[model samples]
Target chain A: MNKKGIIFIVFLILLVLHQDFWNWDNANLVFGFMPVGLFYHACYSLIAALFWGIVMKVAWPTELEEWAEADDSREGG
Target chain B: MSTVIVIAIYLGLLLALALFSKTLFRGTSKDYFVASHSIGPFMLLMSVFGTTMTAFALVGSTGKAFERGIGTYGLMASSSGLIHAACFLLIGIKIWAIGKRYGYVTQIQYFRARFETKAFGYLLFPILVLLVIPYLLIGIIGAGKTIAGVTGAKITPKGTIPGVFPEWTDNGAIPPWFTGLVISAVVLTYIFAGGSRAAAWANTFQTLVFMVMGILAFYLISDRLGGLGAAIEQAKESHKVRTLSSGGEVGTSQLTFLSYMFIPLSVGMFPHLFQHWLTAKSAKSFKLTVVAHPICIAIVWVPCVLIGVWATGIFPSGIPSGAILAKTVGVLVKDPIIVGLVTAGILAAIMSSLDSQFLCLGTMFTNDIVLHNSKKEYTDKQILSMARGFIIAIVIVTYIAALLLYERSVFDLAIWCFSGFAALTPLILAALYWKRATKVGAYSCVIAVFISWITFFTMSGFGGEYFVFGGIVPAAIMWFIGAGAMIIGSLMSRPPSEKTLAKFF
Candidate 1:
């Protein structure tokens, strides 16, 4: 699988682990103003950004295609 | 003397900057609407951040911290900043790149193009308008209240004697309507004169002033609490520090924690932020702006949190947050002159957000909805005129709403609007990323959002005993189910033409 797939799996594992560690009464363990929680939240954002970057790169159509279409429409008409 | 002069000079400078930027407008729709796409990275970064960091941060967050302790900081303020920064880095860059390629001038325009439907755009526009109007009103009311609170303005009551409206007096108790009108007038003047470009230029000046004042206020307040260590000690002593899941029983459910993530996504889809992306000069600049946005977040959130924590120690029984805010300002400095300066900084925070929001909402209405349907060709001048007219109408409507709803908490109202956007974001994101996302799916998602949000809000209105769910829970479930439906619907139904798909595939 791709780097994004690997990253997604890692994040999924971490999220599940973190959720289990925190639970309802213990939820503060992973969600507080403490250093550990802060670090976790930061990492979560970084992973999210990375995943989004990959999705945009792989899934969306190219800018060149859009330009070419605009050109074609102008000429075909 | 220095404080009064400094504030006066700052106000003068901002107004002058607004007027100077006004010259850039040649009455063209593009020029007034999106600043002719000439915004640089520095200007764009400052404008977007300035517009987002309003009185909500300057006063509301700090006040919340004072009342609820450090949990407000961790759960609401800091999380929002971090998530907002993450959004810019992730989704912001992609939107900027796509917008540039497609000549997309508005968020709804981009949505309509990607989803291939004017109907979707039309449906989305009114929702966007509704979500934004409350935020705009908060800024307006905050500004007016701050001005009245600082200046000791007095006003006549709503149903007072004939021809006798409220006026500023030595005694306190300034009427909310009086303050609202003053703020709306000033904002409308600059907005009418310069449009988005003026708002952008004014935002830069206002942001700098706000940052300096915010940092200074934090330092002074922290010192008053006997430095950082003492402040933290006092906060701990007062039971202000908590794990993230800690809040009033109503605020701390597991679902709420999970649902908080939706806010950052909503920030990504907000129309004003989308307009900021469209105004970028290049993709690289957009990336740089996104990466740097969190730095501003750090500046605002850290100090605000400290002040909030300190307030709890100072008032053990929990001074009502808003009253504590007023008293804290009163105690922080005795001089009226310095109070005036600080007050202006607060007003700047409100205006910075208000002006940009008004400009964006106005542009969306005039350009995307009104002109989208109008057959008669409108000149750029006419479009600009309509945009200005829309700004006035929005300000008036929001101001009236603020007056009617004086008892409601600004922070709660702001969060409610945020929840609306959060509900709307998943479908928008799916349209961008998922090729199979269909118009039917998009419409269904919107329908689900309307249903879920109405149900959640109606239940909340009857009080907590009636409903087991909070706003975010139902909203998130609806989004998830709607997204699934959209994908399945698209698969079962007709897809866009190959020619259209090929343009973005």
Candidate 2:
């Protein structure tokens, strides 16, 4: 799959994992303090953040940057 | 007294920073409204995140997590983390690109120009203002409530803190209205002098303050209750940890939780956010904002949710949801200076957004309504003065409106405001991507959004959470209503003109 397609699939997976129904009534705590569901989401947020970093690096629209820079150069000239 | 003094000192510092930013103002409407598109990446990240994460993130979520449970994190904060970043990537970047190319400063300006309809501006300006009033109130009311919450406590007899002034604190605290007035004035002073540049500068400073303060509050409060483990242990027995369906006091039904995914889409249509996006110096400026937004939400939210759930054990009863966070920070952290600084952080989170909101309202009124509809031309100075004047006027008016709404929860008020904006996301989504989107289709979408929102908000009795059934949020329903209206209306009408289409595409 293309980069955008992979990003979209990862986005979908994150959305589904966001629900966390499996941990809903687990009554277990991570690190003896954090609830399972809460811990799951805290990890999820980090992963989502890292995923977005990948998107920024790979799937980013570099064309927009080129256009903005070209526009600036034209004005400068 | 020391607490109030510390808060006063913090506000004074913020005012100084914003005033310093005013020195850099280039003296044009463009400069006043969008910093002449000169903001860099880190500042953009701070301003955008700061504007989006308001008292609604801290004050609203802490209180909400108190009433709800740990599931509150999943329902709103986690979902917001992912969804808000998606919005920046999907909507914000596109808007910034188009805004830069077309010199648009307000959402209405973009919509009006894009749809080739004068009526588009007229139609959207009121709805945007109507929705933003509640959002602005979220900041104002939250600041007032938070300061009052932190200040109303004094360590004494009966094992609780009394209000600073016993005779006039309404049996134990400062009133929200007084704090609201002061916060409004503080925000107004900076925005009046410096405009959007001031907001960005102040938000950058305040975001740093609040994040540091948030972690400090988490650490201090946890130490006071023992450790993080001990604190959660204290509340482990309460419904604060369990789902509502699983014998918990709070409702974390699977369906209700899923319904909340629709709420974060509200960012896709925030006017203040759109204005913030336009301040970016380049398309690359959005990279930091898009990538860091989720973790920022997590950083702010996790502690707030944990503290709130912990509050259930710390104070078993007799605390309003809004006051829980403030009261917790104030009571547990006995030192006056610490309490004052922590509360300052809360106010910082709130005021950071208020300046942007007030500026956007001014931008909409001046650019979308007055300048666009009028025949005569005005100089840059005239436009700047008018915007400043209108923002002051809105501050007073919104402050008064806030007085009438002091009884409502920040969480509930914010949800309604967010729902109204979320219902309109279909308009921008279609306008940006759909070639077949016509002016008639835009009107239909707005009409559908307005009607459904009014009905839902009214049926919600103006201040309560009202689900369509027992499980579904009204915003979840209105999204469909809006998208359906847009598609059907567009299909039934002629496509956008080739000229308009070519300009956008």
Number of the top-ranking candidate, with DockQ as the measure: 2
TM-score of chain A of each: 0.40, 0.81
| Weakest ten-residue segment in model 1 chain B by summed lDDT | B159-168
| lDDT against the true structure, each candidate | 0.64, 0.84
Q: State the lDDT of candidate 1 residue by residue for B1-505, as single tens digits.
A: 3433554576667788898888887676766776766788888888888877878676876776665444454455445544675566556666766665665668877667767788887788888887787788677667656655654532334432221123444344456677687677777888899887888889888888787777877766667667666655655332343333234522233455555555545676678877776666655555445555655766675567557656665665545555555456556554556666666777788888888788888888886878888889887678777888888888888888888766666545576676677777767677667787777777777877777767767866722222235524444565566566667767776777676676555
- Give each prediction's root-mean-square deviation over alpha carbons: 5.8, 2.7
- Per-residue alpha-carbon lDDT of candidate 2 for residues B1-505, written as tens digits (9 for 90 to 100): 7888999999999999999998998898889998988999999999999999887677767877788878888888889888898889889988888787777888887787778788887788888898888778878877776777667755665776567766877646678877888899989999999889999999999999998898898999999999998999888454444467444357477778888899899999999999999899998899899888888989999999999889988786546777777788867887889989888888998898888999999988998878887788788899999899899899999999888877766457778888888889999999988999888889999999899888888888876677778778999999999999999999999888888887677
Off by over 4 Å in 1: A6-77, B1-10, B153-167, B173-175, B236-240, B244-255, B316-318, B407-411, B462-475
Residue A51 accuracy (lDDT) in model 1: 45
Off by over 4 Å in 2: A66-77, B153-155, B158-162, B165-177, B238-242, B245-248, B407-411
Taking the candidates in order, what DockQ does each have? 0.14, 0.44
